[model samples]
Target: MQAPTRTARTAGVLFLLTFVSAITGAALYAPLLTDPDYIIGPGADTRILLGAVCELVLIITNIGTAVVLFPVLRHHSETAAVGYFAARIVECTFIAVGILSILAVVTLRQTAGPDAAEYLPVARALVAVHGWTFLLGPGFVVGIGNGLLLAFLMYRSHLVPRPMALLGLIGGPLMSMSGVAVLFGAYGQSSIPSALATLPEIIWEASLGIYLTVVGFRRPRDAETTGTGAQESRAPRS
Candidate 1:
């Protein structure tokens, strides 16, 4: 048993941050975005602001995962690491756009009376933008990046157990299928099937976060063989 290097510890924390911020952001925004009354009625300013702030933090953490892991991942596959980073960035960009769309609703609500004829349609459009952003961002982009590329890297590198990584690998395609289904009007994004499709990915991410935070990544063989750095304790075999 050995201690994880400073970089591994940092990456572990970043992974946890990514998980927490994403979940918290969704919870914070769900209420404001789902209720039509929130868009039409007054006194949602605070909620809207809070939602926006959470989204911003989500963006930060989303990027943090890739950025923090890049160094270690690059050692295994530089191309994949860069691709994963790019994918996360793309996901965050779409999410940021979605946040702006929802924020537009807040701005519109503040400016227009609930009963105003122009209010409902414009608000609906804004919400639609946000909805599409969600699909494109989390449903598609995340499946491609976080679920697939990240899992592939971790699997090859043995950063986490292969089974845990397999969950993500399997989940990614399912999520992508669901995203396509949503795109084609086969089902709603919030449908049970969609949730089920994403469940493996969710579990993989959460488990990965917990694993990294608790045990950190296995020391790369090069590092171990060279005796160039502090040897990290290996995560338990699953």
Candidate 2:
């Protein structure tokens, strides 16, 4: 009913949308990601095109989450709040780059002649670029932005339950570390270890989204002491 409550719900919906778009995009991209010779074969351009659309949605929702939450989060810590917003921008940039790379692959497939050998290497190279972007953007930056920064803000402000915040606290570092491992060739990107590390951060975001959408932010009892002066001033003093 109130502006703040509306903002929380908007942010929650954005977060949930990010989840759906990201997963759908990734799943749709399987043909290119998993098949080395997909470019030479009868390409699934339609599927790839749909995947691109999903990722485009992901970019919008990703930034929306940060933008909607910035006002409330800044009340607790302006620096971190700004950092989260910036991180979201950076993540979206990576997502955009990845989208372009795959779309390029699709374009090449459409234009290539009967001699597909020449384009194979080029296609593979484009796929590689997308892979790196995926790792760096969602894999690395997400841990810092959503996992550590966002979680820390929620934890400090008690916007959500402490236990939910703890998931991010623990998951952020793990996800980042796993990304580094993948970057260094310690393990494959989709390895069990990487998935294990990513699990907590996923849970954290999902839980936060559901909680904010269903219940809205709970007014912190220690609002006066928590640096949320604006929120405290709005409350009636006994």
Best by TM-score: 2
Q: Which stretches of candidate 2 lie over 4 Å from their true place?
A: 1-3, 221-236
> Please, what are the lDDT tens digits per residue for candidate 2 over residues 1-238?
1238888899999999999999999999998888999878888999999999999999999999998999889988999999999999999999999999999999988888787778999999999999999999999999999999999998887777778898998998889999999999999988998999899999999998999999888665544455554566687878
lDDT of 1 by residue, 1-238 (tens): 2334665667667767766766777777776677766655654677667878877888887888787888778887899999999999999999999989888888877777646446777778888898898899899889889899999998877767778899999998788889999999998899998999999988888888778877777655544454433333354546
TM-scores of all predicted structures: 0.86, 0.92
Regions of model 1 farther than 4 Å from truth: 1-4, 113-115, 220-238
lDDT, residue 220, model 2: 55
Local distance difference test, candidate 2: 0.90
Task: For candidate 1, list the clashing residue pairs, or say none.
Answer: none
RMSD of each: 5.6, 3.5
Q: Which ten contiguous residues of candidate 1 have the minimum total lDDT?
A: 224-233
RMSD of 2: 3.5
Model 1 residue 194 lDDT score: 92
